[model samples]
Every structure is written in C-alpha cells, then in structure tokens.
Target: MLLPRPLLTLAALVAALAAPSVMAIPGAVVTTPQVRAELVAHAPEGLGPGRPMALGLLIRHQPGWHTYWKNPGDSGLPTTFAWTLPEGASAGDIRWPTPRRLPVGPLMNFGYDGTLLLPVPLTVAEGFKGERLDVTLHAEWLVCKEVCIPESGDFALSLPREQATAGQAEAFAAAEAAKPVPATGAQARARIDGQAVVVEVKGLPADWQGAALDVLPATAGALRNAAVPQASWSGAVWTARLEIDPQHTESPPALDLVLVRDGVPAGLEINAPVSGSWPAPADAATPAEPAATPAAPPADTSLGLALALAFGGGLLLNLMPCVFPVLSLKVLGFAAHAHDRAKLLAGGLAYTAGVVVSFVALAGLLLALRAGGEQLGWGFQLQQPGVVAALAALFTLIGLNLAGVFEFGSVLPSSWAAARARHPLVDSLLTGVLAVAVASPCTAPFMGASLGVAVTLPAPQALTIFAALGLGMAAPYLLASAWPRLAGALPRPGVWMAHFKVLMAFPMFATVVWLVWVLGQQAGIDGAAALLALLVALAFAAWAFGSRSLGVRARTGFGLLSLALFGATLAWALPAWREAPPAATAAAAETGWQPWSAERVAQALAEGKPVFVDFTAAWCVTCQVNKRTTLAREEVLAEFRARGVVLLRADWTRRDAAITAELARLGRSGVPVYALYAPGGGAPRVLSEILSPAEVRAMLAELPAVAAPA
Candidate 1:
C-alpha cells in the first residue's frame, strides 16, 4: 500500500512516537550464525549527573568462533567501539583482560571465545547540560573460526537524570572479576638470552615455583606471535622469553604486559621500562644467560644491515629499465679508455664521487621538503612535468649525438673516433650525475625498507644510507676501471665502435618516448602534441648546427626558431600539466581498479570482502612490468573473481597525503607496494614489488575457505 509523501512522513513520525520504549530493546544489535552481540550500561540506578558509570557489552560466540583482543597477536583485527555521546558525556578506553593464544598452524592469534563481557567506563560531566543523555555506540568486530566475518551494529539508549534501577550492574561486576589485575612494586627488564628475548621480573611471590607466568606484549608487531613463549620460575623470581619479529623496524620505549599465574590473575600487570642497548641479531660470544639475569641487551636496531640492503638495491638498479640509456654512456666511456689504466681509474673515482654527492644532495632536499610538510617519496622530482620535460630534452639531445645526427664536442680531448685515449673528470662526473637522474624513477625490491628507515633516521645516519646506495650503484664501473683484468676482457676497440654507438641511440630515444608517455599522463593529449612539435624543432636545430655547409647565421636562425618553438610549447604544456586529469589511480584505466581512499577500504572491510591494494606510480618501471607480467594475467583475474576481491590502486604519481600516510603505515617509502587483505581477521599480507603469479596463487590458497558472496 503506497501513501502520499506527507501522509507517509506523518505516519512514520506517529509510529516512532508511539514506540519510544522500543529503543530500549536490542533490535539493531548484530547477530550472525557464529555470534550475537549487545550493549548494556552498568548503572543500576540510571546515570546521575557528575557520576562515574560503567558499560558492559555482552558477546556470545558459537563453539570455535571468537573475537580479537586489544593486541590481536599475529593476524586479527581488534574489536572497535565508536560512540556518539550526548553533550558533556565521555567514554574511557576498553579494559582488556589477558587473552589466550589461539594457534592456527603457522600463525598465532590472541582473543576470546564463548561468552564474555567487555566493559568500559562512562563519565558524565560535572554539570549536566541536559535533562537526559542520548548515548549511542556503534560496535564493529571480526568473528572467526575457519572463516571470519566482519560485523557492526548501531545501539542507542536513553538515561534520565532521575536515578532508576535500569542498567546491568551484575554484568559489570563479572567483567571486573575477569579484567587483568594491575600490579605494583614490580620491576621487569628484557634481555637477549640466546635466540629469545628474555624478561626477568622482581617482587613476585617467593617459592612460587609451580605457578605459571605470562609475558604478553601490549605493543603488537614487536614479537613473533607464533613462537611458543617460554616461562620459568625460580628463587622468588619469574622469567619469560619471547622471539622478536624480524621485520619490526622501530621499538616501543616501554613494554606493558599483563601477567597471569596458573590460569589466575597475578595481580601484577607491569610496565617494563627499557634501560639497555639493543642486542645483535647474530649470536654473541656470550653464552645464553639464566632467566633471572635479564641484563643482556635485547634485539638490535640494524644500521649496517640497512646500509648493506641499500647498497644491494642500488647495484640491482643498474639492470632496471630506467637505467638502460645510461648503460650506453658507460659503454662509450669504457671503449674510449680501455687501454689506459690510470685514466680509467681516475674516471671511475670521479664518477663515484659524483654519484655520492648527488645522492646526498637529493636526500637532503627530500628531507627538507618533508620537514616543510610536503607529502612525497622517492622519484618525487619526476612527479613534476617540468622535470619530466627537461629530462626528455636532455635524452633527445644525447640520442641525436649518439646517432651521429650531430657532433657535440668530444667528452675528452680526443675526437669522436676515440683513436687516442684521454679522460676528463668533468665528463665522468657528468656521466654519474646522468645515471642518478635516470635511476631516480625506479625502485628495486631491497630498496623499500632501507629507504623507509632512512627518512625516519637522523640526518647523519640518513646520509650514510644514501651514500651506501650511491657506492653500490657505482660498483660496476668502479670495478671495471680499477681492475684492468675486467676491462681487458672486453673486445678490443675496433671499426665496429661507430655501429655500436649508433645502435645505442635507439635506447635513448626509447627512453625519450617513455618520458613523453609519462608527460601525457601528467598533462593531456594536446599538451603532449605541443611537446612533440617542440621536439621536431629541436631536431631541426641540432641538424642545422651539425651541417658542414651551414654558415653561422643559418645555424643561429635555426636556434632562434627552436627557442621560439620551445617557448610556445611551455606556454601551453606547463599549464596543462599542472591541471591533471581525473586519476583512476596508479593502475592503468583498463584494469578495472578503483582509486583508493581510506573510506573505500573501510567500507569494503565492513562488507567482509577481500581487498587487494596496489600502491604504485607511473614513474616506477617495476610497477608497470609487474602489472603487465603478473597482476594483469587472466589467471589472476579469474582468481580475483572467484574470491570476490575488491581491487584498489593508490596512485603515488603525484603528492597524495593519504596515500603517503598509508605507505608509512605499511613501513614503505616507495612505489610498487602490494597489500592483500583476507576476509578473515588479520593484518594485511604484503607482496613483493616484483610480483609473481605463483606467489599470488600461494597467497590466495592460504586464505580461509569462506564462501564467496553471491
């Protein structure tokens, strides 16, 4: 039966007014096959003004299904309670009890099963602003067994100032008994004992040899959740050992743990303050210490390891696509000084110096920009259209010279034929600089964590990391020049040098083409066309200047024309590039990927659907390659479809604050980050930048066997 708009509105208002008491019922409370949940206040006499009250949430789960804790160990989401309080009302933090470690094969989880009462404090203002309190809480939690379901509910209740015995005080009492007891006069410290982080506690019960001791870290992600935590009690002291997580980059200054004894509350939750240096990852010469002695340093924060990783990443960058054009330069430099040992060594050193200097300068600039509140990452310069266009022009000129279309002056005093050996420091230094300029657009696998930590570290340490990367990048050239044997292995310089040199020009041109495509993405089609026309004028200028017959006046005229064409191109291109097209994220438009937003991710998670996030940029060669070779495959598409996964791409080609924050949250500082979140309660599993279909298949196979949404 359909009614007129006004009549329907009036009827709804009447129905709502008639059933005001229905709000007291748990109609909007969430109930699933595995669990049922509700919200209840602990104020037996209705909440009074300026009084402290408690709220208890009753959650009951079917056998084998459970909800997570404040620290959900390995891979699970903590339960969340969001409230919309009436004026002058506030809610305190959730009081969490000690959780039991639930082992699932290789992974471990911390949570509660069966029935539980979760309590929180509700504080009313000193002077009540209103006659009644309209309290509303939105609860969201993940319930799981073999499969997990994300659920939420809206609950509201009204409390009048007049004291009324209407709240669940009994439930609150039960929760208080279940809560972990806070311990005083207790001091604890952590130390490295063999392969484990051992914590020793003082001021516990004497002769408590048989009582159980639990050391649970309040800081999630600091320790390995799957490892069985070992505990021992001796001589009125208790000791517990935990294995540190290898991937944890930063450590909390203080660790808080809830202690339990023999399935009973120890009345001793302690905040352990750190006072010692970090331990080495490798086994120290010192033997494993007794549990009572917790003075040995704990897991170390790696600086040398980070530097080594950075260097390795830089070495691998030479083979990445972005560095291909520079390879040709290296080849020419090599052939020119193949027989001169001193010149070769000098050139290599100069090149190495240039790379190191440039890397330091870039790192300084990046840090300065970050301090000034710019949301950016590595290869950020390429995000600017001006930088892209300038690089394109430089590559085009270099390509023309290599193709023999024009003759720039010799890199050394020797002529183009390289018949005589001569080396100039400026030329070698410039080669290193050019290599860095091109290499900035690419990020190899091992670079991520090193770069991520570099930004967060102090200035001097950060510079060291960047310097290490530069040294690695220059290793190949340095080795060839310093070691005559390596250089001697190359084929002797010959008449074929010209042919090889000319062939190298095509790669430079290809680099120019790629830059133009990137420009097109930054700008639009019209802007790209203008840039192409400008390139034509540039080519003409080069040809005119190189001509044997052209006089000075004619060359000058061509140069003027090129200058005018470039001016016109910039007039149109600059403005257009600044005006970016509506982005469909870093993923290409045809891949059916949606642009990422925190809201979108939250919404998808609330729906209990799986999500795959691709954090990438157009400047990242690895990102594009991975997209083409792995993520775009039909098999991957079928897998996604079968699992009902929502795909999102966080485009980092430009400055996106949210995306940068997300990257930092994931402990990454560069593009090509892939995160796969399963429908079950757990932290997202990160994938390698250089993705493989087999890895993706294996990741999917490990997920719980939940039925796909229809």
Candidate 2:
C-alpha cells in the first residue's frame, strides 16, 4: 500500500509536529513511552448468571511517574473508572493490590509505579437481555514523578456472551491471582498513645511469617497518609503508630486496610476486620476516661468451699509435673538436716516465709499491670523472652551446680559459702521460691475458682486468698517437718543423697529445655538461638568462675571478664530479640482447631454451633496438661464432633488484649478458663479447671443434640 506523493509530504509534516496517536471505536487508546492507558475485556466465559465478571483497568506508567492507590496518600489523585455497562450489568468494588510508599518532600504517597491492573468485578444479574455486552469506561488519573499531571481517556470494550476457550480466560485468572485473598485470623485495635494513633493487628496468616503489614485506609482523609507509619511487633501482633490528620473531621468507621505482606505476591493480600478497644482521641477538650475493665466473675461456691478447694488443689499440685521438678529442691532441703529437728524447724519457717512473700509479690504485680493497661494474667512473666531467657539460665545453673560441674568457689565469698554450709536456710527459702514460680502456671482443680475470686476481690481479701494459697502449697513440707515421725521416715542422709540430687538435676535441665521452647514461641527461632548461646556463655563463665584450682586473684579476674562478656551478650541480644519481626503463630490445621478470636467465637455462636474455647497459654502447665490429657484426645474430639462443637484454642501465650478482654467478659483472668457456648445465643457453660476425657465426653453427651454446620 503506497501513499500518493502529494499526500506523503502532508503525513511527513504531521509526524514532524508530534508523535502520532492511535484511535479506537467508541473509545480512544493513548500510548507514549511514559504511559499506556487501555481498557481490557476479561470476560473469558462471557458473564455467569448472578455472578461477577472480571474487568481489568490496565495502566502502565514509567519508572518514576506512578498512579495512586484508593487513598492516594497526599497531593495525588487516584485513578478513577466510571463505567456505563450494558443493561443488567453493574460494577462492584475495585480490588487493589499492595501499594508502594512514594515520597515527595515531606509527603508519603501509596501507589504503583510500573504496570498495575485495577480489577473490578462486574456483577451480571440473571436474565440479562443483551447478547453482546458493551461497556464504556471514562478513566481519569493524576500520575506524578515530581510535578503532577492529570490524564483522562475514554475506553470501550465488547464482551462476548458465551464462554470461550482457555487462552481467553488466562489474563483474568492471572490478574485475579495477583490480588490479595481475604485475610484470616483478623483482629485490630486502635488507641491514642501520646501524639500518635496506634493500631494493632493480630492474626493475619500463619504463613505470612515475618511479613510486613502496610495499611492504607479506605477512607480518603481519615489518616495523614503522607506521614510515615512506625511499625513494631508484640509477639505475633503487628502494631503501627501513625500521625493522625488533625484536619480530618471524622474518624474512619472501621480500619479497613489493604494488608500486604512484604515480598509475598500471592493470595496474602486481604481486606480484613479490626475489632477491639478504639479509644477516642487523647486531646478532647474534656478528656474522656477509659472504659472500665470488667471485674473477675463472682464466686459460685461459698468462701469455705473455695478455701477447701484451694487446699485440695494445693495438695494435688504436688503430683503435677510443674511442681515435681521444684519438689526436688525441697527434698534436698529435707535431706540436708533429717536428723536435726531444730535446724529443720528453722528451714521450714524460712521456706514458708519465702513462699508467702513470693505469692504476695506476684499478686501485687499482677494487679499493678492490669491497672496500668497491660493485658496480663498468671504466667505473664514467662510470656517475656527476657524473663524466659533469665529463668532458663537460672535453671541451667542450678542443674549444673547439682551435677557437681562446679562448686561455689570464688563466685561466692569463702565466708559466705562457709556460712551457707552451716545454715541450709537459704537453700530452703530458694526451694519455696522455685515452688511458687513453677506453680503460677498450674491451675489445679480448686485453684481456679479461688484464684478467680481472688482477682476480683478487694485488695486485702485478694491478698488473704493468695496467702492461703501459699500456706496450702507450703503445708505438705511444713507438716512433714513439724511431725518428726514423717521427717524421720526419710532415708538416712548419706551417699544416696548425692545420687538423688544428680537425678533431680535432670528435671531442672528438662524445665530449661521447655522454657527455651517457650522463648521460641514468644520470640522467634532466632531469639531462642540467641538465648541458647547466652546460656552456653553462662556455663563457660560459671565453669571458669567456679575453678577452685585458679587462685583468688586469678579467679576474680576471670570472673570480672566473664561478667563483662555476659553484660555484652545481654545488651546485644535483648533488643534484637524484642524488635525482630514476629513469625506466624502455629495453627492446628490437622485437628481443625482455629486460633481464638472474639469474632470467630461470636460467629460460631451465631451459626448455632456449640463452641468450646480453651483459654490457654504456652507457659501454663495446667493448660498443657489438659490439652494432652483431655482436649486433644481422640475420645474428646469425637465427642466434640458428634456434638457439633467448634474447638477454639485461645492461646494466651503472649499478651493478647482480645483474649484478656474475653477472659474479663467470662469473669476470669487466666488460662484454663474453659467455656462452652450454647448452640444459639445463650450463656456459656464454664467447665471445671481440671477436666477428664470422660468428663468432657459426658458434658457434651448431656447437651441436647442438634444438626452440625454443613
């Protein structure tokens, strides 16, 4: 095809003017090296009846210039698509992919820089009239590199009415796959912390371990989008501190964030719900007080009955695995002076005092933290990686000392060691401390109600109950010493005592292993590894410091050097452990046990399914005991299945505010709070702390049967 010579110069003149433009029917296509704007039809199988069809709003931008997300941070306008679809067809929401943060001066913008497909689901109503569907899209966008320029164009596409072959569907499928799927385990909370708005999100995807949560509000002006978000992790929860836009007159109805896990380009994107306490802005003219926290549930049993339960629970605790390791220390104390009654009396008194003092201290701290806005309960200390690390080290040292790895050489002054050798009182006191610390995580039978009541009671009454618990715990050992016949029944203190102590050290070592695992759960594998390294360093320090062969001055020098190394290790480790991005929490997919959330619980209740919630913590020995013995057993699970029960494991291993709030609602404040929701909306049946498989089965079997969810 050759142009006439006369017209060729005319075309040349047109080319010289500027780049030529391409045109289409009922629409226009604008293309340049910097951007390409087009409307593409994604109807592979035409439109399904009463289903949504895909339509891609394709825009390709240059490296520097980019289009904006829904809430285009600051100083830019989002690309808009106004569509006129054929009769019986309408557009749904635009599904946006994860956004990038673009900076221009002091402003932060969220958008895409390269190719982006703003996909919309076009809902086609049933009984449509048209054979071929025609759509006209009027598009407008402000693309910016530094200076901003607004662009607009019209696009038209004809969608076929019938399903086509595979290639016709591939583009839409690819586009859909690239978008974020709905997020699971969704929870969010907002509050004012100083000048910033702090929003915390819990339970995204377990697979999104170490993922970054970048949130863009659905509302245009709810946030100062240009302000950078300061993110931090609290266990598996992600929190962002953002600068609130003072100019925005209203807060967002809800925090709807386009959650994007960093580096994950698959189905990890989601629009999820945020449910928790969202406090009003802190700078209100008349400051509003925070909502009052719910008190612990009222005591169902009489005070005398609760005390009896406490005593019985305390007695049974001696048999719990949590207390078994600690009892070894008491056994050592009992053996140290089996034949001498006066020293034994002094030892018992000191041990009892230690137990009572520890309980009082722990109760005070729990109350203080609760009052100070910390969502915490028993075993809360173990939830801290630092605390877990320290406890692990302590246990390891004790185990090593028992194993005769070293003596209390230069580390303890010679005079102090000499004094300890005579008294045996310090050993007894420490033994009691160990007992209570270990016991904190165990909610033996009657302990639950007593402790539950103690939390809500007046301070003095709570303290009295705690004191009673301490005395109960100390009773077995105290009674044995006070009654000479029980003490005398002990084997004669001799060579066997050495062997027994070494055997007991293994339990201490085992406890260390468990604590280290808990650290991994609280922090991450890296944190656990760091702690293990610290323990190794501590062992080396102890081995060097306890060297009797090294003289006092040399030992002292080695000790000081080791101490410096220890300090450095802690200083380097703790912050990193605290600051590292949280890994995905474990879910029991094999058993169909979902992570606990108030939303899930409410949903299950609304669905008319009987829900069983086990409020547990990783550090709670009693909770673990229940899990192994009853909750996870096949018999109990079958019963649950038969009864249409939804088993929800509310792990309070970390400080979860939702779980805490739920616990408060249940009138309890700790793990091992088992509640079974009625089929519909009804009061939940709070079960006993100590549950047997038979008991669980019996309880479920007793409920009036109903059809389970399909």
Q: Which of the numbered candidates is closest to the native, going by highest lDDT?
A: 1
Q: What value does the lDDT take at residue 611 in candidate 1?
A: 82
Over 1-710, each residue of candidate 2 has an lDDT whose tens digit, in order, gives 11122333677666634432211234536665457977765654556675446776778798887888877764466777899887788887778776777755334667787877788887777878675677788887866663344566767766656643133255566567666666666677776654456777778667765566666665665566666688877788888887666444346546566656566664443343333333444321110111123334444544556567666766777787767888888888788788788888888888888888888889889988887867677667776777778788988998888888777755689899888888678878878887888777774345766776677777776776777777888888888888898888888888999899899899999999888887777777878777887887798789778866778887788778888877767765685466322323564553868766544554565566777888887787777788889888886777788877888877777666557766765657677888886643434678888778877877788776656679
| Model 1, residue pairs in steric clash | 46-164, 75-682, 76-682, 279-298
Q: Which stretches of candidate 2 lie over 4 Å from their true place?
A: 1-301, 418-423, 549-572, 579-583, 702-710
Query: What is the per-residue lDDT of model 1 for residues 1-710, given as tens digits with 9 covering 90 to 100?
Result: 11112333687667755652323533436566777887777665556655557765789889988888898765557888898887778888898756777765445678889887788888887677575677778887867665444566667766655555344566667667778776656668876544456787878655344576666667775676666678886766777878766444336666677776665632357776655554433321111110011112221465677889889988998888888788778888788788888988998999999888888888889889888977677778888877887888889988998888877642223364353324477778888888898796585465887777778777888889899999999998899899999888777788888898999999999998988887776666765676677677777777776654667887788768767876666666666665555433235465657776544554466577778888877778888888899888999877876777888887776556557756765667788889875543445677877799999888887655457668
Provide backbone clash counts, one per model.
4, 3
Evaluated at residue 470, the lDDT of candidate 1 is: 93
